[model samples]
Target: MAPKHDLQYPKGAQNTLNRYSDRGSYDLEKVHKIVNSTPVLHVSFQPDPSDPFPAILPMIGQMGSFERPSSSISDPLDCYLHGYISSRVMNVSRAAIASGKPGLPVCIAASKVDGLVLSLTPNSHSYNYRSAVLFGYATPVTDTEEKEWAMEMITNSVVPQRYDNTRIPPIPAEMQSTQILRVTIDSASSKVRDWIPSDSAEDMANKEVVDKVWVGVVPVYETYGEPIPSPLNKVEKVPEYIEEFLKESNEEGLAYATAAGKRPLPVKAKTNHDE
Candidate 1:
């Protein structure tokens, strides 16, 4: 049988995984899943000498292949991040290109904690998590078509079918104020921890620690709150699409967390590519 085409990037060399190397993966599918599943991505970059320290911001983004629109998570793709047009990071990216540099170097980090592990010993306490770190160069997206597509893609990701349910295309002024950063990842690595606690032989031998203490995994998940309708809204009822979305999405989160990365998370409703 042919082997799966795992994500091929600089492994331990570029972003080394010191501990738990067994749980680390360079596979594109695994890494992309963690990145997309995470609603907020923390991006870090070096600041100019005028700044006091490194800059890190929680931003929203997704992985996509614009050229190959049908590309799957297992395929090579670029990370498109949404930001304000006048933001300092965006300005730095724009300046880098003018200086003959491809883009600004950045580090992208994301994670999802599935459960809290309670073990016999304090040292054994840990979180069941899926995490990833990507090393990349970011540039401000300039193409009109790609930028529009990315904006719509991001909107749909938040709440399925949300883009169409609202005003169609945004106005020119709205588009002008928004900016999208295209991050071309050079290499990335993902780490996952979802196993039951394994107590040391010394600790296991002690009946008080093993039997008396509550040692187990407490599942954690994200769920949507009740949808609030506008006071001036004209709709008679909550649309089935939204109700269905809430049901499916909320259940999917619980299911995925319980499964502990063993199953794929449910897909979000899509949007019109032309929108």
Candidate 2:
């Protein structure tokens, strides 16, 4: 894989790192890849006046540079999120823009755990992880061309080559029922923690303590299970594309997790989100 070129997001009040700031990264490639890799994003937005508290939702979203369709996930791009046409979030974005207010402001967060860190001392335990947060202004997609492109981009993200494997284009009913939001990111930051456990010098020097406890990272990752076809289907065999994709994906996940378990941090630019 080609190395992702890093582009740093300008530091701002909203995105400045405070704790363990050395781990914080403003690199656009790292931030965007984390956001895209997370299976579910936690999106927080201001609630309606009727509610006293802010609201957040678990949503699936994809990053797409429609103008630069071939752009990698690490590239700076607009986040296209899918939701019901009448969903409160979508309605809020529209209402905000229509009222001459700046588009609805939101915070997007994603995270991944790579390993379980074990230490002789309980207080020193932690997990190896990568997490990111992005602040953005969102607007309801208005152009027909842009909307269609976003829809296809999101569909394929659910599974590799899924959009082309199952359907050619969506029907009118499907398109009308779904809504897309284009989020233009303003600032973002990511923090990564991947390293050997840091136990106290006393704990490290004690042979009794070291002998009694197990210490090492347990690699954690997602893997694809065997595919089960629909009962009504007449096909006797699975599609080659589907089989190949599943195999390759599993291999990639295993290889990465193994490497993570052996090293404190990866040296190459990551394209896949590993949580």
Candidate 3:
């Protein structure tokens, strides 16, 4: 097996994981943490069993959702559904690995922002974010107990205590309605980007041109709204568990909840005070 550290990529593919391998390698610890921290995985492989596989899966699904997005959406429902499907796919991929049919590795990415840095040169433009990526085969949970635990891990992975608050997963007979797969990790890497712009010689020469326009980066962030109770449930008072979900600050959690058919919290109306 090619150690994740030894895996190679075509030129132009940034090797961000090289320096962060010790912390980034998708080992058991990282895998568990990742599965718990976020419920998403970007999976791709040569679908053909023969060589010269000339096809790639469509990036967007029929519903206008993608395995990966260049930018995050503000809608919590959209975000949650995206993560739910992504996590399910990842689980299936892992199950394939556990079945002894080791498939291609998938990429998992999580990014956080510190601040944006503006620069005088277009080439120097960038932002600060803490990100980690894992390239590994997901191991399957075959044991019934382990499988259930994996499911719970995935559930709580999205929203802490979510499974405990909601109904526990059904037995295999009932779960059969849903598809589940597991994968074992083989190798992986991690990386980060946090550099500020340093003006190059040409940029310095064109200082006037650079200064003529605004040259600062606008920071990006993910936020959540209040929970909208289900129409079926007419309880005027919201449950603490559901209310706590609203107080949580995970974009992935918000996305997962929305995808699971939960409604987003309503926006609070503001009052005009002493005019």
Candidate 4:
């Protein structure tokens, strides 16, 4: 039997990493995981051809296949973005579809800093981070079934099983007001830095400089605070799902960041700033 190999997004000029190329990956699994785990994504798109400035909006999005619902993260998936119906991005996407274009061109980015790398010099300082970028065409989801499914998936991405816990289905008014964009990705890539601080050999050999300068990684992770209830809430205690979600999410984040903080220095890591 042939060995199974991980699927990768083809590297192209649109989604290629130039500097620090060693840390970059085209693996679909790595890229999708970073995007799905990120709470907010920055989506950039041009409103019009004559517009001077491109618009970048922080949006909530999730990656999944509507046709193959059970597909894994490594499998190809479209990014589903939630936004207001009348938003500029949505309007542009709608217009593009109406004009018979494939969809509106967009770039989606997600990033998370796990640790702050304090090196010998300010120039050498960096962050232990994971970042992904995707170039895609954003088309408005017009089908009722697909839109609702995307909504449910996005809601669950925030808190596991959250969609079912709340309303079974969105009300007519809510459905009418919300808009979902299905992004067909052309290419994707991710870059990760998860090693201990790197410093030049000259700096490391200098006792005075090494003694004076503190060089290490400070782990950073997001923490979820206790849930505050609404004024009209009847329930005295928080739901178990909410409590468990917070605990598990916090633990997972801390573990990842802390592990990165303690990671051994890479053998081939660039010691000089220019390198």
Residue 80, candidate 1: alpha-carbon lDDT? 90
What is the alpha-carbon lDDT of model 3 when measured against the actual structure?
Answer: 0.42
The per-residue C-alpha lDDT of model 2 at residue 1 equals 100
* Segments of candidate 1 deviating more than 4 angstroms: 1-3, 50-52, 261-275
| Ten-residue region with minimum lDDT total, candidate 1 | 266-275
Model 3, residue 223: distance off in Å is: 1.0
> Tens digits of per-residue lDDT for model 1 on 19-107?
76667788888888889989999999876758889899899999997899899989998999999999988988898888998899999
Mind sharing the TM-score for model 2? 0.89
Report the Cα lDDT for residue 256, model 3.
37
lDDT of each: 0.82, 0.82, 0.42, 0.93
Per-residue lDDT over 1-275 for candidate 4, one digit per residue giving the tens place of the 0 to 100 score: 99989999998889888887888999999999999999999999999999999999999999999999999999999999999999999999999999999999999999999999989888888999999999999999989999999999999999998999886789999999999999999999999999888888888899999989988999999899989999998889998999999999999999999999888876568543423
Write model 3 residue lDDT over 86-200, tens digit each, in one string: 4545455555666677643444444455345566656565554445443444333345654454455456545558878775666656454433334333333343333333445
Ten contiguous residues minimizing lDDT sum, candidate 4 = 266-275
Shift in Å, residue 167, candidate 3: 2.0
Reference-based lDDT, residue 14, model 4? 91
CA deviation > 4 Å runs, candidate 2: 1-5, 265-275
Residue 235 of model 4 has an lDDT of 86
- Output the TM-score of candidate 1: 0.90
Task: Give the TM-score ranking, best first.
Answer: 4, 1, 2, 3
